[model samples]
Target: MRRHLDRIDQLILAELRHNARIPVAALGDRVNLSRNAVRQRIERLERDEYIQGYTIVEHTAEARANVTANLFVYRTDRMRGGEVIAALKSVPEVVICDVMSGEFDLFVRLEAPSVDRVRAVWQQISMMTGVRDITTTVTLSTVIDRT
Candidate 1:
């Protein structure tokens, strides 16, 4: 029988999405699974095509030349608004999302091939149910990036 994804499985996928090169043992620790168990689940996910492959984010000047923006997301129900986060996961361009303490609830960073695409993504986020408001700012240039 084909296996269905559980919350643990989803967590594993989320961790992998953030850092594709994360060690299986470390990933297991984050998801509260054993190393072997995590390995097996990863293999199953790959075999089942849930995980096709892993790739690195380019940091070259040419790559950085693409459109990048920050989205200050204000949530209506901050404590109960997990739906907004789940929705953000569906957007491939959203590279980073930080849950914050005051004012805005989420700080989202997105990168796209063009300004139009970034605008479209911004529009999409603004329309999600729990999202109260979104203030967007496009990056002019990267002065320093350690990573």
Candidate 2:
């Protein structure tokens, strides 16, 4: 069964999403609760799986300058899909991966210094165990990254 969140629980989640490192005292002030109360609520949220562990987003000049590429992969050998996925995960060039339905079995997102580098990565992927066909799209500008 799924659990329903109340208004206070939703408020806590929203505030945490904005800044996970926000101190309990500050969070309490914003939510009109005591520090201990806020802490308890946060703990409950974690226990209930509403709150996952916090993460940090590191932004570097190299990351900002790199070109983002999306690759759509079609696998011929469905049985070897797991091996192909593991190989993709091992490659540092692959930043994101997803198993999809339809023509392509896997979708990958990567960052490279140039378009040529993206092509090289695609070639490497194509040579991997299950990869059959690859199509790529280079992103010109990112309007939104709702991560």
TM-score of each: 0.60, 0.63
lDDT tens per residue, model 1, 25-103: 9999999999999999999999988998776768687887779999999999999999999999999999999999988
User: Where does the lowest 10-residue lDDT sum fall in candidate 2?
Assistant: 54-63
**How far out, in Å, is residue 72 in model 2?**
4.2
User: What's model 2's lDDT at 107?
Assistant: 88
Task: Find the number of clashing residue pairs for candidate 1.
Answer: 0
Query: Which residue pairs in candidate 1 have backbone atoms (N, alpha carbon, C) closer than 3 angstroms, thus clashing?
Result: none
Q: Model 1: residues >4 Å from true position, as ranges? A: 1-61
What is the per-residue lDDT of model 2 for residues 1-147, given as tens digits with 9 covering 90 to 100? 337888988999999878888999999999999999999999888888887677777668766788889999988876567888988988888999998988888889998888888888888998997788888899999888777
Where model 2 places Cα greater than 4 Å from the true spot, the runs are 1-4, 58-64, 72-90, 96-108, 123-134, 143-147
lDDT of each: 0.94, 0.87
Cα deviation at 8, candidate 2, in Å, is 2.9
| lDDT of prediction 2 | 0.87
- Give the Cα error of residue 37 in candidate 1, in Å: 39
Residue 34 accuracy (lDDT) in model 1: 99
Top of the candidates by TM-score: 2
Steric clashes per prediction: 0, 0
